[model samples]
Target: MKHDEFIRRVSERAHVSAEQADTLGRAVLQTLAERITGGEADDLAAQLPPELQEPLRRPRKAPADPFGLDEFLRRVGERAGVDGELALRGTRAVLHTLRDTLPHKEFEDMVSQLPTEYRELLRVDHDEFVQKVARRAHVSVDQAQTLTRAVLQALAERISGGAAQDLAAQLPPELREPLQRPRDAHAEPIGLEEMLSRVGEGAGVDEDLARRAFRAVLLTVRDAVPRKEFEHVLGQLPKEVAKLL
Candidate 1:
């Protein structure tokens, strides 16, 4: 998805404003880059959106050092200007999204390079994915699935046409439909509120709950697409929408 759309989605999921999502997303991604080997970081960077890739590419001030999950959360929290708890939540949100977007082996290889504790932080199963969203959104598993489908469809609309198609290609068959759904190319851009409304309508939930679900899916899409294409997607959005990214 586009950068603005991606941030807006994360903001909804993380229960933060767009600006806060931007801050948290960058912090989590940058800190993650520092924790892993340069080659591994580069490999992961190759798969991220343009606005997010730089965090993984910039030279680290110090060599990567071995660290546990607590230290990882502390560093990310410090950089994100949030407490450790909030940082940990944001990191999980980002990582879980990564798990969904990447191919299984690609995701596994990146996780393999990390310390053992890192594995638990990054790894997620299908049941866990559904359960986490259900808990956070206060919705049933069935509702969460509906929400997930709606959010992915909405995201496909915001991403550029070519990028959207590429994203569909990457997703599993179960997810490809939402990403490949047809949308009007010349339609006027809508703000987060409208997006949430559509998600609510599609998921058979209220706007408040839909917002939560929207964020959950959007955060993942942000890290899933190529950064350059994501930047282009951001540029095409309205100013109000762009501010969110």
Candidate 2:
């Protein structure tokens, strides 16, 4: 989005004047710069309009300040000279806009730096998740749905029951069903190639399509689950399989 349009959206969403919206947008970006790694902030700034990028430009080696939501809002409110409620509204407006505008991986990288509270602020619903995968994989929604279930079912078989359950907990209830299926106690670890084959056979797609869908599903799953939970899932897989994620 253009700088002016971005400001307009924030103003509209927060019910503030354009001047106030500009202040709030800068405040939120500055606070976010503090919260995330300097490198990520730089990358984020690159995608934003030049006028809006100033707040996100920081020292290359600056360490992130460890802060939660309360502290985050406190800093935003103080920096923007707004009340707590307006600060909260403005922060949501800015971040929600960022989510819509940034690439999935770039936004996911920023979200990964925050805690569970921040993740909840940008939670993806089932439809959104499917839509994201479909867009990423260049497939239809129905194809994405079938491919998602196939990938999850194959993943469930490969990982330990506990790990699968943990991952399933983070997914929507509809997506959770595939991960809920019974697993063989002695099932062998599946390699990356085998996984692609299984997903291709199960989803009735070609190998290339399966590979693309598998990556799309895993990347989206990484965004949906907590960083630690996603890491736990990775830990269960062979290095080859884990690298695919």
lDDT of 2 by residue, 112-155 (tens): 78887876656557987898799989999988999999999988
Q: In candidate 1, what are the lDDT values of residues 1-245, reduced to their tens digit? A: 45676676567656788888888888887887888777777777777678878888845344565777898899888898899778877887777666655664566677766776664554344455555567667778887778878977776676666656666654445666877744444433677787878888887888778877876654444444444444565565455544543
RMSD of each: 13.2, 4.9
Model 2 misplaced regions, further than 4 Å:
1-27, 34-49, 57-115, 181-187, 242-245
What Cα-based lDDT does every candidate model obtain?
0.68, 0.86
- Residue 38 lDDT in model 1? 75
- Return the TM-score for each candidate structure: 0.49, 0.69
Q: 144, model 2: CA deviation in Å?
A: 0.9
lDDT of 1 at 50: 82
